[model samples]
Target: MRKLVIAISMLAFAGSAAFADPILDRQALMKERGKIVGGLAKVAKGEDPFDAAAVLTQLQALQANAEKLDVDALFPAGSDAGDTTAGPKIWEDMAGFKATEDKYLADVKAATAAAPGDVDALKGQINTLGGDCGTCHQTYRVKKG
Candidate 1:
């Protein structure tokens, strides 16, 4: 039983170490950010109207990229993911951190899907998505020097 527990713990640690490089995670995040923001900007401006085609394309790409960046793995619980500007508050306030990512993805997906049908309504949803971002930034992110 003890050996089994140790094996499982070791596997979990190895997985975290394999995936938890903040530099790479940050880079992955930046790519997703660019796609999601640019995608939604097209919607906010009402640039595409009924089509929303470009926004949809970018949004889909954003979602795909987002799936690769896990909020749970944002912290190096045991292994080092490097010195993140993320701060210890994120790890300590784990529920808050997870909720931010959860809402971001959900809001973006729902809003993007509806954009093609009702541009105005979708715009409102998009604003909510942006608001989620503001909330997360307020909690988790530090202002750039």
Candidate 2:
């Protein structure tokens, strides 16, 4: 029926509009980045066996995720509202925020190129990567309860 079609169209538009919010988009991307780091962390912590290929795969995925992050677009002016945990420093010091992002990407690319073959190597790589993540989070993220 025409009414059914209209209702379905409205629902689809509503769903898409919800996802179109930049806050939601950046949060989703950050969640995915966390998952990739978590996967690598398991191996680094020895909770998971170190498989060279698997570690490389995760590193590559991390690179892709970092590369996909467009901080300017994702964290545009006036997008600091809603459920976001972004710190005020991010907007106040946009240049510093972007520099951190660039550093993270560079570290990921270097680690990927290095391609750790053993647990020790992977641990070192993870440490550097984790440090980069921590620095950014400490400076640019707000803790929410």
In candidate 1, which residue pairs get closer than 3 Å at backbone N, Cα or C atoms, i.e. clash? Answer: none
**Candidate 1 residue-pair clash tally:** 0
lDDT of 1 by residue, 17-121 (tens): 645565566655756686667666676776755455666676677666555567656455642234445656677788888878888888767755665455675
Model 1, position 36, has a per-residue lDDT of: 69
Q: Clash totals for all models, in order?
A: 0, 0
Candidate 2, residue 76: Cα displacement in angstroms equals 0.3
Which digits, one per residue and each the tens of the lDDT, describe model 2 over residues 1-145? 9999999999688656643678988898899999999999999899999999989999999998898788877899988888899998999999999999999999999999999989899889889989999999999999999
Best by lDDT: 2
* Model 1 poorest ten-residue lDDT run: 76-85
Models 1 onward score TM values of 0.68, 0.86
